[model samples]
Target: MCSWMVSSYFGSILYSEMPFNVEIKAKVSNASQLAEKASQLSQSEGTVIHQQDTFFNCSLGRLKLRDLMDGNGQLIFYERPDCGGPKLSNYSISNTPDPEGLRAVLADALGVKGKVKKERRLFLVGQTRVHLDTVEGLGHFMELEVVLKEDQSLEEGEVIARSLMKDLGVREDSLVTGAYMDLLLEAQG
Candidate 1:
């Protein structure tokens, strides 16, 4: 059964991007060459990233939820097939990473607000095969994403993501993103 719970109070997410998130996948001879290209920018420092999407195993429209760590702004989120709210606002920014213990430290530094909204989501991007997203909660979102390839290490992508999150404005202790089913259930009328 699907239920549209309005969340007694209200839950929201605040996010932004650096520069359109330039997607690049080129063949390089070695790590050195890759490094040269990944960080080669006119006036910006860039990195090579391979997105290991964790949407679903089979189901055409499969999405998931994750807990988020807060940063500058009071927000947390992750990719979902859909999401919703009053939509108070939306924007992007330069992000920073958060280390393993950052969340604990955040408890002392930053403060959280509002109660987390329990929701039921609906992922209506596709039905069968093919990969093209008609995301909800506006065009689409890039929440808790693994940076993929950061600096020369395997887990560097996550590190970079954390850094960007901090530099941008994401809090260290926040629900990364809620279940799409929850969001959709709320909007279903």
Candidate 2:
């Protein structure tokens, strides 16, 4: 069941301290090539992350707990439009010291919606974070998260996103509309 729930739980997320996230996501046919291209533009070694994101049922917003193989975990809540283009995602992430305990708590409290497992290759390009993902049930995908500075405007973020899109060879038609959890739910049906 594909769902986007909006909840009053937004206040529970650490929105006051976190920066606004401007981002875009696209399905990549050639993730390796795109990673190579991103690497060429930015001289940085990509970090490989094996992650599992477990979503929970909420009343108003999307909430998920992301557990990384590196032992770091986070509980994330975000409210963003499901548009197939560049969009500003209002989100908050709180680091978890006990991911296993929290996962069990959230599962028993809200009920688990779905889970998404992926191996992500992350690269940094100036203000943007590039992710080349190979999902377990899905496939290859690329996501760009442009972290906006305190003084930066949304338009500026869009400009940066567009430039990176062109550089990374991401096409408008390849953009996806919802979260990976949504896709996973749809695939199940």
Candidate 3:
């Protein structure tokens, strides 16, 4: 079990204890084509969401405030390897009714690292969530997150993630190793 603490800048924060997932991210050459395949596989049109993610500097792991832009948001802290292909991510989330106020507190206390704004089309395929993201300044990408049950092993999650990647026509060569923030920071330099 990983142990960490977040300050009570936001009152009544919800916490999930060490939930993990096996996930992959890839650069999408054709957004519409991938969206069609994802929709077909899931048998439903995905939900469209606009997100503004503000990353804060943290000594351990990566912390970000995800503003859903619909009066709801999540403060997420996650730790995962910065490598290509399917990898395990251990994370926790806290829901907030007032994201703007929380963002201000976190930004001031931690200092801002960067921000990523994107339009995401989210699909549910079995136990997995397929995200078709159009990221500002970074183009389109597809992410597959296989949410692992408590009894599930990491290999099982990886198998599921790889299968979804194959189903979505995500090539190994197109796989990206890091978050959109890393890409944006690199582009600025």
Q: Evaluated with lDDT, which candidate comes out highest?
A: 3
Over the stretch 94-187, how does candidate 2's per-residue lDDT look in tens digits? Answer: 9988888999999999999999999999999999999999998889999988999988876788889889999999999899988898987888
Expressed as tens digits, the lDDT of each residue in 71-143 for candidate 3 is 9999999877677888778788999999999999999999999999999999999999999999999999999
Query: How much is the lDDT of residue 34 in candidate 2?
Result: 94
- Candidate 2: worst 10 consecutive residues by lDDT? 1-10
- Estimate, for each residue in 39-124, the C-alpha lDDT of model 1 and write its tens digit: 33112343222121112222222322122333222213332222221111112332335322433444345432212222211111
Candidate 2: pairs in clash:
5-60, 5-61, 6-59, 6-60, 6-61, 7-60, 7-61
* Ranking of models by lDDT: 3, 2, 1
Off by over 4 Å in 1: 1-147, 150-154, 178-182, 186-189
* Cα RMSD, model 2: 4.5
Task: Give the clash count for model 1.
Answer: 37
Residue 29: error of model 3 in Å? 0.1
lDDT value, residue 54 of candidate 2: 94
Candidate 1 structure, TM-score to reference: 0.25
Q: Which ten residues in a row have the lowest lDDT in candidate 3?
A: 1-10
| Pairwise lDDT winner, candidates 2 and 3 | 3
